[model samples]
Structures are given as structure tokens and as C-alpha cells.
Target: MTAKLPAPITLTGRHVRLEPLGRAHVPDLFAAGGGDEEVWRWIPTPVPRTVEEMAAVVDARLADTACEPFAVVDRASGRAIGVTCYFDASAEDELLEIGGTWYARAVWRTAVNTEAKLLLLTHAFEDLGMGRVVWKTDHLNERSQNAIQRLGASYEGTFRRSRRRPDGSWRDSVYFSMLREEWPVAKARLTERLHAGAAVPA
Candidate 1:
């Protein structure tokens, strides 16, 4: 039997909007994702270099039931600023992996990134009733590792030489996960941080 998929989720946070990614989002997404070579350095696929390429990628993603990607829109500017996804969703195991995340440098280190993650995690754990949410990053990407740790996800060790990157180099991947038992505390902490950041004067 085919596995059941989670209903398309549209999540809006204090600083960002998460809409199901579609072809229409390509033009804006290409603009958001391009211009930053560093952001795509650790990513597996070549960064979308043009609007047509971005549209093709979004189209393929839309056709894949296993992956539910979202266009990350900055609420302040009302512009799409990045992309994220929940891939490798296993309904039978009540588990899902949140990966393929990339954001523009303009929003890096801001509350918007955290809010986007909080929205995705909340939907995965509380809304879809998932037992665990998994996160992984290239071991060489310390920034990503630190961000995941800040989310209170337990470090599950690294997979040595796990996969090859687009640059023809081996990438050891560090894995992290937050269990259902840990969700309440994690959720509360993230909620407090997001609310506090929102109240700050720009």
C-alpha cells in the first residue's frame, strides 16, 4: 500500500511565511536563492542560476509526493527569501526529516530563520503528530551545526564520508533529532524567543 502523505501545510510565523512551493514562486525564488554562492556551497544540488532552472526544480519537487517544499517569504518585505522542505517522510514510522533548507544572507542570523524553523517543527510534531523530527547538515558546516544545537536537538553523531557534494568532495554529515518527549520544552523555548524578538524595535 502507498503511504499516506501529510496534507499540504501553510505556516505563517512572526517574520516569515511558509507556502507550499509551486511554479509561480520560481521568479521570486530564483532572485532570492541566486546572488549568494556561499549559501549553496554545502547544498547537494547546483544552485538555481536562472528563473527557468528554478521553475524546473520547483516543478519536479511538486511532482514528488515524498518531498513537501515551501517557499520562505519574508513577512516584512513580502518577498520570497528562501526554501525549505520536509523530505523522507515516513507515515508508518511516524517520523519525518526536515532538510534541503537554504536561506538568503539577508535573513541570516535573524529571527526570521528561527521562526521559519519553529513553524516547520510545530507543524511536524503538533499538527501532523510525528514522533520525531530529524535534521542533518554537512559536518563541515559549523554554522548549521550550531544552529541545530540552538534548537535543542540532540546530536546523534556524524556519518563519515556519507555523500559527495557537487564540488566533487566527500561530505560527512552530522545528524540531529528532537523527539516527541522533548517537543514541549523545545516548543516553549522557541515560542518565547520568537515572541521576544518580534517585540524588538527595528
Candidate 2:
């Protein structure tokens, strides 16, 4: 099968469902994270001070051909609690980056993030036949780095002066990746953790 950008689809797991992001998710998305400094701290964009600003963020992602954005809905609550994306898609290279991820404070230490990664990684490597899935975060964001490492991604390296942060300071990005040949082992570990009730550490 040829690797390609995933078409808009719903990915369901025991803990959450990732749906194609849309305007309908805006209210819940805003309520979930808008203006929460801590939630947006490590993110590239500044904290959106209003729902409209958050909506613009979502809209920009939607307009970008390179990104497939999803609204992460908690199955138990039936609410959009977060956002994620499969971005920087390269069909020929058989790879994509799983970035632009953030969830509400309420779901921060829950199974939501773990299961969401499971669903996304499964779809990328299993369904789309991608050879690699990449993840990156600010070098100082230890919490995010730990979460990515917990998912079994190997630390590729750090990219110095990668990009300017919202506050106008330069950010050094820490990169990690998992390969297709390594999927079975990584998948098994992630699945076991999810089944064992492992959550993203606070």
C-alpha cells in the first residue's frame, strides 16, 4: 500500500475518539483550553485570549494541506477536550509528524493522551503504512519529552534555535521518532500501558 496523508476520518479508542476538527468543536475546544497559560506554555502559539482567536488557530490548521487536524473527544463525556494533528505529511518519504497536541487541564493526567497516541500511531503505521512517525517539543518541556519517551519514541536529537516562541524567545526543539519496523514492539508497550491504566504524568 502507498503511504499517504490520512483522509479525514474518525479514530476511536476505549478512552477517546478523534474526529475531523470543525467549527462545532470550537466552543468545547475554547472552553477546554483557551486562555489557560499553562496549557499553552509549551505550544508555539501564544495563549489565545478569546474563542475567536482559538477558532482562527483551528481554521488555519484546517486550511493547511499538510496537516490533518482532529478534535479529541472524550468518549465518557462526549466533549472535545483537546486537539492533535498528523502534519508535515510526506507520502514519498512514508512519514508524518504527530504534533500540535494539547488537552484541557482536567484531562491532563488522564488516559486521554496515552490512548490518543495509540489510536494515531496505529493508524499511521498500520493503516497508512507510514515508515516513520515523528514528535517534537520545546527542549525545556520535560513533561512533554517524558510523555513522548513513554510512548517509546527514540530521542533523535535536539534542534538548536529551531523557531521563535510566542514570547519572542528562540526555542530549541527536542525531536523523537518511531519507525515502522519498530511499531509492533512499541505498539505492544503502549497497549499494555493503556490496559494497565497508565496516564500521562502531571
Candidate 3:
């Protein structure tokens, strides 16, 4: 497989669709996540107080070339409910990290996140032909750590005081990675979960 990064493209799944982030999503984005302290706790930026602040955050991510941000739209409601991104890409090594993800409180334990990861990992390993996909989270964030581990990423170690959080405090970053060989099982597990979701009645 050649070393190449995923281009900007929409990834559609049963539960959600990943579209390029844009200003048009501002209203739904804000409605889904804005002003929620718990939702923004692990995020690097402060909780957005208004729609404009959230739009500013979107604009900043759009301006950054190192990342490709996407609006996670729930297919059921046809509204933007979250955001995720493919960042820190290294085309030479066929490596990249999927970070910068957050969702509305309502969809926290639902099929939304599971299917989103399925779509992303599938694109990374199968479509982009990436050798590795990395994930990182604050050491103190146990929920995030468990989520990454559940996705079949091996816990790699922590970088002490890796970066400063929005609160001006040091954050230890715990890293994890899933190699190409491990994707099949992970993909299977995610697919099963999504199928289970589809089987349930509304």
C-alpha cells in the first residue's frame, strides 16, 4: 500500500454521516453541545458560551491544515450532533491520529460513537491504507481511555506533562495505537454493535 492520507470526503454510515465542517453547521452544533460543561471538560478549549464562540472554534479548526474536521450528523434527526477529526497525519509513515471528538450528552452511550469510529477506522486502514492509527487522551480521563482500549488500540505509554489544558494545568497524555493487523477484529466488533443498534426499535 502506498503512503497517502485520506482526502476530504464524506463518510456515511447507518447511524451518522461525517461531512466536512462548515459554518452552516453552527446552529445544530451549538444546539447539540454548546454550554455543556461536562461535554467540554476533556476538550482543550473552554466551554463555548454562545453560538459565536463555537463558530470561532470551528473556524480555527478549519484554518488548521494539519487536521480535517468533520461534523457528525445523526441520520435520524438530520442534525449535527458532534465533531471529530483526522489529525497529525504522517503520509511518509502512513500514520495518523483520530482525536478532537465530542458528542452531545444524549448520544453518549448510543450507537453514534461506535459507528463513527467504525467509519473512521475503516477509512484509515482500508481506504487510506494506513499502517497505524493512533489515539491519545488525558491521563485523568478514564472514560476516554476505556473507549480507546475498547476499540482494540494497545495502550502505549504516557507522556508526562505533555501539554497544558485550557485551565492552565499540565495534562499527562496517554497514547494508544492499533496496527493494520489488528483492524479486522476491531472492525468486526464495531460492525456487530452497529447492527445491534439497527435492530432495536425506536
Candidate 4:
């Protein structure tokens, strides 16, 4: 709570636009991946079965002062495809964690995610002046861990039984981080991938 996170802002890129999340995004979001178990597999929340449920999820995030949530909009179709956020920040330490991210099944490994992260990381380091950006994912989610590493984050270790999953099972969280000093190289690599369309993000 010590960190002063930025107010919600829109970040536009060639493949996606990250706009402040709202109830208005529920429908497109629901259409994008609602009721699809795969899309919500790694998300802590249970699969939202209805637009109303999706609205509730969006509302919950809006009510959390610590979170700055964004609805990821695919530029080509002008539809919201998913959500991501910035939370768990500490201003005294000049650090923050970016978690609560999930994209529609269709856009899973496309340039959409690559461009979106490029925009977010640029803002986090250059605009917000954060010294470090962190990420945490389920220990069993190797695909996600790989994705984080692809973004140049260094694995920091794991927090055993950090939280319970939606299914009520204990979950161990794996942590990763990227310091400001490492952003330049990571940024270059991310930019190049975006320029290349990053079809599968090898």
C-alpha cells in the first residue's frame, strides 16, 4: 500500500490496447473466453459462467484500491480480449508486482501479449520510475513461467502454499523479477519480437 501506482491509463499498441477496466468490458470479455476452462485454468478465480459473474469480477477488481486493472483490447477487432493488472506495490522500496493477467484463448501466443507487456514495462520503468517490477505465477504453470522468463525476468524462487486455488487446493507461487538496470536489454528484445510478430514466442 505504500507504493503510489499510476491512475488507470490507456496504452495503445499495434496489436493491442490496454484500457482501464470497467463493466463495459464484461460482454466482450465473456465472448472472448467466458466459460472456457482453459482460459481460466491458471486464474485464481473460478470460471465466470455468465456476464453477470464477469461483471462481479470486474467490480471486485475496481473496488480493490491496490489494483490498477486493464482490459486488453485487440486492435484488429476492437474487442476486449482479457484483463491484466498492477498490484502489490511498495513505494518505499520502489517496487511493484504485475500479476492477475490472462488473455483470451485465441490470442494466447500472438503479438498481442508481446506488445501489451512492452507498453506496460515501458510505463513501469520509464514513466512510473519503478526500480523493480515483479511477477508471480502458480508453480505448476511452466508455460507461464516460460513466458515470464521470455520477458527477461529472473526467477527468484517460490512461496510454498502462498494461497488456495479456486478449487480449494493449496498453491505454491513462483516469483520472478526484472530490475530497472535490466530493462533496456529486455525492452530491446521485446520490441524486436513484436516487430517480428512473435508468432509463438520461442
lDDT of 4 by residue, 161-187 (tens): 999999999989999999999999999
- Candidate that beats the other on TM-score, 1 or 2, i.e. the better one: 2
| lDDT of the candidates, in the order given | 0.82, 0.90, 0.88, 0.88
* Model 4 vs. true fold: TM: 0.96
What would the per-residue lDDT of candidate 2 be over residues 88-183, giving only the tens digit for each residue? 878788889999999999998888998999999999998887899999999999999999998889999999999999889999999999999999
Total colliding residue pairs, candidate 4: 1
**Residue 77 shift from truth in candidate 4, angstroms:** 1.2
Q: State each candidate's clash count.
A: 0, 0, 0, 1
Model 3: per-residue lDDT, tens digit, 1-202?
3322456889999889999999999999999999999999999998998999999999988987888899999999999999999997886788898999999998888888888898999998998888899999999999999888887889999999999999999999999999999999988877876887641110
Ordered from best to worst lDDT, the candidate numbers read 2, 3, 4, 1
Query: Who is ahead in lDDT, 3 or 4?
Result: 3
Give per-residue lDDT, candidate 3, residue 186: 86
Off by over 4 Å in 4: 1-4, 199-202
**Residue runs of model 1 more than 4 Å from their true location after superposition:** 1-4, 198-202
Q: How many clashes would you count in candidate 3? A: 0
TM-score of every model?
A: 0.91, 0.95, 0.94, 0.96
Q: For model 1, where is the 10-residue window of minimal lDDT?
A: 193-202
| lDDT measured at residue 28 in model 2 versus the true structure, 0 to 100 | 93
